[model samples]
Target: MNDLEHVKPAAAPKKPARRRFLLSGAGLAGALLVGWGVTPPRQRLMAQAPLPVQDGAVALNGWVAIAPDNTVSVVVPRAEMGQGVSTALPMLVAEELDVPLASVRILQAPIDKIYANVAVMRENLPFHPDDTGNTRAVTQWALAKVARELGINLTGGSSSVKDLWLPMREAGATARGLLIAAASSTWQVPPGQVRTQDGHLFHDASGRKASYGSFAAAAAQATPVEVPLKAPHAFRLIGHAAPRRDSRIKVDGSARFGIDARPEGMVYAALRMSPTIGGTIAGVSPVPVLAMPGVLSVIDFSGALEGQTGAQAGVAVVAHTFWQARQAAAALSIRWDEGPHAALSTATLFEQMAAALDGDDEHVYHSRGDIAAAHEGAKVIRAEYRAPLLAHAAMEPVNCTAQVSGGKVRLWLSTQVPTIAVDIAAKVAGVAVADVELHEHLIGGGFGRRLEVDMVAQAVAIALQCQGRPVQVIWSREDDIMHDVYRPAALARLEGTLDGTGTIRSWSSRGASGALGHQFVRRNLGLPAAGPDKTTVEGGYDMQYAIAHQRIAHSAIDSAVPLGNWRSVGHSQNAFFKESFVDELAHAAGKDPVALRRDMLAGHPRQLAVLDAAVRRAGSAPPGRAHGVALHQSYGSIVAQVAEVSVEGGEIRVHRVVCAIDCGIAVNPNLVAQQMESSVIFGLSAALAGEITVTGGKIDQGNFGDYPVLRMPQAPRVETVISLSSEPPEGVGEPGVPPVAPAVANAVFKLTGQRLRSLPLRLS
Candidate 1:
């Protein structure tokens, strides 16, 4: 059996509920504030409970376990969403433990405070990258503490490796130290005399050797001695292209995704959601559906759960099989209350945002020098850009299997936030959090979709009516597309001025969009996050270009579209708006686009190097193709891309994309390259044809035919160049996504002489 199929028969040690944890945190708030200056960050090296050791295996701290045969198991708390985290993260441990990578086994982690995603939360702070003042520092410190206390195990923001870099390595080193100490004691020698390599301890002087398994029991009793992490030069697994551990299993079809989950006496449920956003089921006609063959029951799924704003409450048809349930669901008639957003439409949303942009409700997120003074007597250029709401469109449709029996709940699903999932399950099932057990599966594709628990809540709600039997709730492709928490539609108005020396003296960008972070906190954490939202103006406000007078503002417009984080969050669209406008500035100044960007990036060497690398690697486009370049930084990584494009049969054909990234150090250079290629294709799909429109508060597109992704024939040849850097790993998953759209859009301008300011780049 695969390691993913293994689960401890005994119940894991209980952890505090999220609500109770928050209440306790509130109680300690006063003391924390008093000792704010001296309190250290929470230690992540140890778990709150012991590791779930298998038979004949010994626990070695919270992260690793050693078995009788010297097999090692490393617990990875983050979701493996085809990002190679399942491979890259274990390399961190294997490198420090001085073991061959193949000897380590991957295990899904249970709920633990030590696995909280503090790095991604810190990245969400509304401070500019250049802002290193006390306010930024203090806010980050407090936020990190809050994140640790909350302990929401999230897997997005490309933060899995970055967050676990130190903790995982330290865990390995700590285990290695304990084993060496145990071996040295047995040999009657000094601790330094026993060296560890390849899962074995050696006392070379005495010629005594033993496997780590031999010292496992002794190591558990030994007091842990602090061990130093391996320097980069000594690393054997990291910084190399280690094969993805999941590749073989996935290739051979043994990898289990959420949809593949099977439980004894399992039933299938087909959900028929409300047609409109925020709508609820008024009544379900069960006459014919109840009489249908294999049909179990028609369940009323009405009312939204807490923090599940904009999620549709509908009816579920339960049956013996998915096919039966789907047929019954389609045959049933359900009345819906369309709610207040019945008249909402995409055009109206744009109108509302445009009005907000012109109004006085905007907050200036970043301001440098005097924009008015710098614009005086300078050549002014102005433009507007728009990006439509987008769907995550992950390969696997949303699904979850829930078993509510004997006053306990068991959940099997693919989720990016297991902690949040457990909370939602407990609350919905009316059970103590400890009574809820979650079996997280490998996500076919997350791309930020599984980060929400609305689907989990919906599944559990349907399962409750199954009368103690397990029900696997599956969403049809149409259901998944219509009910998706979509990426926010955004619009930006930009202005720039060129001086007599052809230098950009002033830059001002005003963006309008639903505040994703604020909405996310409301929907995910059940808290209203007020004040400035960093995600609303990230790529625009945090540009690396060294403009003297720069002002970036954002107006948080209210909409019923139900905003959620997409692949790159705000940077996905903001980069296109900011970089396209920069290209406009370059064209107006009669300078090469790359050259103008290079001049402005004089102060940012890493960004400049990445930009130059893409340009140089691209060299020149093939005959009849033009090249366009863009640079963007997000999640502590800098990425630049050059798109080669041409117009054929009235369609924009991108023949190639040359990408360069400085994501600090690529833990797995092969994964880095794969991510770059994936990002380019994903972003290209959005730029070329991806859009989610709404009419009368209803989602317009339901399946891929209408909302198409980039097919293989349309996928551009992607050449990824990784910069050799000594900096700590940043993010490869999302940083590469922010640059591809702008690069392709700018390239289309060179090829067609038409500036496409909107997404799905249509020819006029």
Candidate 2:
């Protein structure tokens, strides 16, 4: 494979110089004093329990804190699941705050209402033009309903920084404005006369200066104003590559992941859940586990919250050590009610979905122009695609530490939804949500798996049963793999017609998938069924391609298997189906995939721009390499990926991948590049080697040994080309995922002359 490190830079001109700012010591002191003084003593006291003010710093949520010593602390709301949000998010806040990257310290934000993400709420609205419901009116109603139900918009749908981009920067800018206000007041000068730079506030003409620390207390009293954000040309720290704030801590093993947490008097708990989905505990005997070494107690826990299927439900063995708990839990004898899903099998699920696809029951997600006439007047090509159920396989598995005392419960866990964790823990522990204090620790990885609060509830239950002792509930790799909220298996049938001139005439896609709404309804509303799931219809309804005559419909089939969001949610599977079918249509029209896509996307300048750049960077036609290109829009970003592949000894070898992304304005180019690479690897792994097969309602794969992730040796060389634009920053975490699988699969088709429709593209 050719080394990408040696690739020459493209002919694009060098970027313009960015605006620069540095906070002086006086500015820092002024900001700190204002922050301290404005924050009431009562509020400070309320923030004290389980909320630690780091040495030399005053706390503000988990992300932003000002220290008496002139340092800034930034709390990261989302876990660093290797997607680079940890670094990118802080850059957005620090850029407008006028603090140097080095002066800012990143802290994991605690799970609370204040820190909940708002983007998920917006995405949940049924406002798309395709829906039959009064799209505008229903959207407004749904938005209000989502806000009322969720309490706080929580993270998911790759909307961490994108959701917070404007708000968080506005927060920083608001704080800066207040600091300047405070400094001006302290100096007895007009606010307009005071200029803030770095950590210091200065009256340049008067030569008077004060550190932000000195003004912080006073600034905290000033009501935040609606200041206009800085223009793109004024961005300094945002566009540039700053060293990752968590790099040093992660490299030094000082980062506290869920597994690293150990509270005082902590005991370990291990559970043996039923082998089937929706199973419940029927009977349990503690006598078998009590005599085991280090076993403290064995208790039956059947009080799980509704709608959390696949969670372990049975007796838990609590002990001094995790190993002891595991041993005792394994040795304990228990009886389970396998529930109604005992007869479930993967084959049965596929059959049920196929039946749904053939049935008259369907929801029209999108429709445009005259699809019937277009199809009747042209040559048509059709194909069906299938994607299997998948597990999140987060590196840390599922674990949480909880201590319940009296009416209060304290929790430490690596959770994407900390507020939800607290709520569920409070419910399980029989306390108010406010009484549950959650310490959001660094996650080993989340990937949408931690969004569920089952583990948190389990920990609370175990802790409550342990009297006042803290109990850490740990899920082994086996437990995590066997019992997880899986990504839904889907079947998509596509029909595309081309005119005699090779112009596309009609496009139609029919899909059957497990309901994502069911999980939401079960968790949020306590209802067993909402209407048909909207998530199952996302990518099809939101297709960015300019196909004039098109229809996308979905059949929401009930599955015995439990399903929830994976990394890219619905797009992970839908992108493969849509793009691969597009490639097939391109081939049928006797056109190059790139050229065909460009022709179809005549009005989508941003999408076409990324597609053209990625193809150029990949060397449109390389020697001994077949290239496949796919462009997709998800999470408000357009990404185009070109994969170069070669088949050797019946194994598909991916040599390199060139990715071009137009995520509007990149906060940190290096971080964007890194996340793209990470997303590519993650998506590629799922395409070539990921699947969770089941038999008799039990997962066939147990650990990494059976369900393998992509190893370093199999990883391809990744090259990312970013487009510079002045538009608002879109999502970076999941946009890269949608294009990878289709790109690679199309390349494999080019090499073999045979289309591989399924995931884990096996050689037959």
Candidate 3:
């Protein structure tokens, strides 16, 4: 008898789903119900539960812990996906705690509301960047409180440093204060007289000294009082090039990704999902797979967990080894019900977008002076741009090791959203949320792919049929690429007018794409999006170009294409549309692209300075190489890039790039530079050769052979120049991505005089 026949998968609870719907739908109504006067402030610095202690380590608070052996550990909730959150965030604590950077270790934070990402949510709200009024403030405040209550622990949006800047600092200072109090009590000295440096407390008066470890036990008992953080000038570790903590592990091959999980007595499972999106398994023949050697059983996982938005109904083949499982799964014959999307294709979706654009369903995001009046008798330039669907293509394929037994489930995976993962696992295994044990590993690459928890749910459902043994379910490269929640195909129509003096007088942008935030909420939170998504019109409306008459509108077309967050979300593609159009206006007006952009930056000093820095550093392209410049701001960071391009035999080769960023303060300059280089490569790959086409409702690309990233030889030499500031640090991970595509497109135009409007820019 098959093990799956004996096991029963629990039905997902309806109450929590209803609660999620109500909470997500309430929006302002819920905020009003809990009046402002009665609303409690979100407590980010406090621990909702006890931090797990190990190896004689005593919990200091939610964010810091110390062992008896002089080892200090700072707990960070964000996932490490090569963006260096594990290293950069610890700098915040180590700076305040006065510990050597090497001496401090990192601990993965537990799933809790306190660890929920408030900054990412607040930044993602629909408010425009220039809207700094009371309405935006109150909405942000109320929503931040709601985010805490909702407690969605996520790591995307480049918000790790920005979110934990204060909390980690205060946790460090609070821990430092507790240590001082402990030393003062033990040595019979005044707390003010004791000073700390390099993890040691010293009193020159009595010639007494003690390591932080020596006072760990006593510090745990002492009441933690608020201590003032060190001024920026007095900072030691922060703003310095602290070597990455995970460098040795990653270089030496010790870092474990989700696919590296190997639990003892673990069975392997290979999944075969439906070929068409939203398709299901109609029937499967398990006898053929069961007769094969090492094949344990064939388990049907269709509708295992109902109401999961992006979940794929599939069949899993369990065997002793992954190769065996893979071969068995491939051998199994199953009839698939392709569903309504069987007739869908990329062309069909674009047609729908075109229809939507033609219709008057466009929702205006931002409006200023009359664009119609400004366009009267003005030099009008109109253009339409298209960006195709894109897959995340993370280095490690989506995999999860899960064990469901005794009304409890344990999961081993690398996920951006741990809380959602836990909830999904519990729901699939028919257990309480508290019964789920999650051990997070370092991600090979996230790029917003791990933000969804459908894989976790699928893994738990597969493990349920394993006779209590852990099952590691892995998706093939083909499955990962084909089944990805893609970056929605986008279309934008831009109309702009240049005045007699060649100044951009009016700008009108109309865009159409699947509502990524809506789909994201449905898949991750089990609810619909509350209001207007800032992501749809981010790059178009939130520009700092000083345009007087501007109107940005987005017509959200609901399509069958599964849409989720790409690296920079809407800015990833919108920058290409906006900046390319700006280039068009410049050329039409007979002005240099860089000089025309400079003309529009009178109000934004930081953006102007960044653009000037890039231009100065890039200089003129040498000989045949032409220069293209683009300026874009995302996630509170401003980035300007100058791409030097030379075309040979219709191939666009980017020789070098000069990038300038004003991300306020750089916590770790080295990490910031790494992200800039990484973003440039990622964005350029998509611009030069990234596309996910669909035919007969099936993804055309299987792996890197078809959907290729930029190889090392193709990568440009990136030079990152950081602007100096004392302001708080903004995001660098994604801000660098939005400018690279347009910069290259604009450069290609300068070189070949071909204004390529579509993505994967091809010259005729």
Maximum-TM-score candidate: 3
1 or 2: which has the higher TM-score?
1
Q: Which lDDT value does model 3 have at 633? A: 90
lDDT value, residue 458 of candidate 2: 71
Residue pairs in candidate 1 whose N, alpha carbon or C atoms collide under 3 angstroms: none
Q: What's the CA RMSD for each of the models?
A: 5.5, 12.3, 2.3
What's the candidate order when arranged by decreasing lDDT? 3, 1, 2
- lDDT string for model 2 (1-764, tens) is 32212211111111222211111211212222333433322111112233355675554333456778878777667666666777788777778778877777666565444455556655563335334466555443434333323445356777777767866786577768778877777778887788778878899988998777777667767654345679999988888887776788889989888888889999999988888777877766676578899998876665543333234566678899999999988887777788877878889888999999899899887788988888675778999999989998988889989898977988888877666676566556666666778777777877888777778767776676788998999999999988888899999999999987777778999999888757644653333455546678777777867788989999988677777779888889999999999999989999888888899888778888888999889985566679988888888888999999988898988889999999888888988898899899999889888899888778888899988888999999999999999988888888898788889899988988979898878878
Query: Model 1 TM-score?
Result: 0.96
Question: Where is model 2 more than 4 Å wrong at Cα?
Answer: 1-65, 107-112, 126-150, 222-227, 303-311, 524-529, 620-622
Local error of candidate 3 at 610, Å?
0.6
Residue pairs in clash, model 3: none
The Cα RMSD of model 2 versus the native structure comes to 12.3
Residue runs of model 1 more than 4 Å from their true location after superposition: 1-37, 304-310
lDDT of 1 by residue, 1-764 (tens): 43212211112123244463231211223333455535788888788888878868998888989997999999989999899988999999998888888999988897888999988766666678877799778767776776677687999988989989999999999999889878877888988888888999999998999999888999988976667998888878889998899999999999999999999999999988889887865665677778999998877655424334334667788899999999999998777789889999999999999999889999998899999998778767999999999999999999999998897999999999998888878877777888899998999899999988887887777777788899999999998888898889998999999987788889999989998776777777665466787778888898878899999999998767888889998999999998898999999989999999989888889999999998999997888999989999988999999999999988889899999999987899999999999899889889999999999989999999999999999998999999999899998898888888888889889988899999978988
Candidate 3 displacement at residue 693 in angstroms: 0.8
lDDT of each: 0.85, 0.76, 0.86
Steric clash count of candidate 1: 0
TM-score of each: 0.96, 0.89, 0.97
Stretches > 4 Å off in candidate 3: 1-40
